[model samples]
Target: MKVLVVEDSDRLRRSLGDGLTKSGFSVDLAADGHEALAFIRTYDYDVVVLDLMLPGQSGLEVLRQARDEGRDLHVLVLSARDQVADRIRGLEMGADDYLIKPFDFGELVARLRALVRRRYACKNPRLRVGRVEVDTAARCALRDGEPVHLTPGEYAVLELLVRRSGTVLSQDQILDSLHGGEYAVSSNVVQVLISSLR
Candidate 1:
């Protein structure tokens, strides 16, 4: 999965980027809301970890702009302020989840996984389609109760399709979802991957 961390504090930002990378997610970092907006415009991220207090623009403002622009990005707000009103305001502004500062890294990972899963309605973290089952949290796949090895690219494609089952995603959308703006992808790559999946 790919994630964007928008935080003003350099220490926290680096920590988040490093920790998420260690957790097997491709992570991008932005020091302020303006940079965050730029990243959002150019990339597709599974989830955004946004800090409410920011320079250039406030995190709430960024969230509002994203919603107004019809960007359906899942957001998880991180704020030092843990007041009930603040949490409610963040949710009202379109944040999917909120985490207070001084939090456990494990808890953050669990919450992020839950948020992403809920966004895709992946009822079982172990995703099952036909004879294949994918354990997303474990990053493993099985076919007919036996292990089915897959390259990272192939797994990414399968995960994207399974996350949005029944939706006919065009090739461009598939490519964007897989790379998250970190790499340029060929438009025909999706077709090649789909053929391999079949």
Candidate 2:
């Protein structure tokens, strides 16, 4: 999955980036609300981890604008504001989930996964398409109930295709989801991945 981590704190941003990358997500970092909004507009991300307190614009404004544009983006507000009113406002303004600061990394990851599943309208962690089954929770795939080993890039692309099974995604969308503007690869790369998946 691809995720955008929008936090003003450099250390927390880097830590979240490294941890989420290791946990099998393509991550992009934004320091503040302006950069966060830019990334949100440009990329097709599965989930966004947004900090409420930001420079330039507040996170709520960013969320509100993104929603106003009608982007199907799932945002999880990660803020230090633990008040009930704050959570209600965040959710009321279109946040999918809200987590307080100093949260468990594992819980954050789980919440992100749940949001992605919700995005795909998937109620289960295991997804089946024809003879292929993807155990998203396990981060593995199986064909005929047997293991099918895939490179990380191949798996990422396959998961993207599976999540948007009925929709025809453009090459640019695929590339954006897979690399999140972090890599400069040609369309041929996506073609190769598609061919390999086939």
Candidate 3:
């Protein structure tokens, strides 16, 4: 899945991006609300890790604009604001989930996964399309009862397909969701991944 991390702290942004990428997610980083807004408008992100206290536009404004524009993407507010009012406000503004800073990396990843699943309206963790079954929480796939060893990128692609089984996703859609508008995606890359999966 594609994740946009909107954080003001350089270290936190890098850490979250690197970790999420390692865990089989395509992640993009935006230091403030402007960059985050630009990315949000230009690309399709499954979720955005937003911080409330930004340099220019606050995260709330960004969230409000996204909702007003009818973008159906998930927003996970990751802020230092841990108070009841802040959390309620974020959710009230259409954030899908909220996590406090000084948070556990594992928990953040888990939450993001859950949010994506919810976006797809997938209730089960085990998503099965024919004999190709995906254990989303475990982040593994089984083809005909055999485990498939895949690279991080390959797994990300497969997971997206498995989630949207029986549907057609264009190369642009795949690229937009997987790379978060960073890479110049070619048809060859998507072809290669599909071939590899087969």
**31-137 in candidate 3: lDDT tens per residue?**
99999989989877878999999999999999999899898789999999999999999999999899998899999999998988787665577888898888877
TM-score against native, each model: 0.70, 0.74, 0.70
The CA root-mean-square deviation of candidate 1, after full C-alpha superposition on the true structure, stands at 4.9
lDDT of 1 at 56: 81
lDDT of 1 by residue, 1-198 (tens): 789999999999999998987887778899999999999998778899999999989999999999999987999999998999999999998999999997999999999888777876745678887888888877778889998788777788888887778888877667766633343445577777788878
In order, the Cα lDDT scores of the candidates are: 0.85, 0.88, 0.86
Query: In candidate 1, which residue ranges exceed 4 Å CA deviation?
Result: 122-148, 157-198
Identify the leading candidate in terms of TM-score: 2
Q: Which stretches of candidate 3 lie over 4 Å from their true place?
A: 122-198
Provide the RMSD of all predictions against the true structure, rounded to 1 decimal.
4.9, 4.0, 4.6
Full candidate order by TM-score, most accurate first: 2, 1, 3
How high a TM-score does candidate 3 get? 0.70
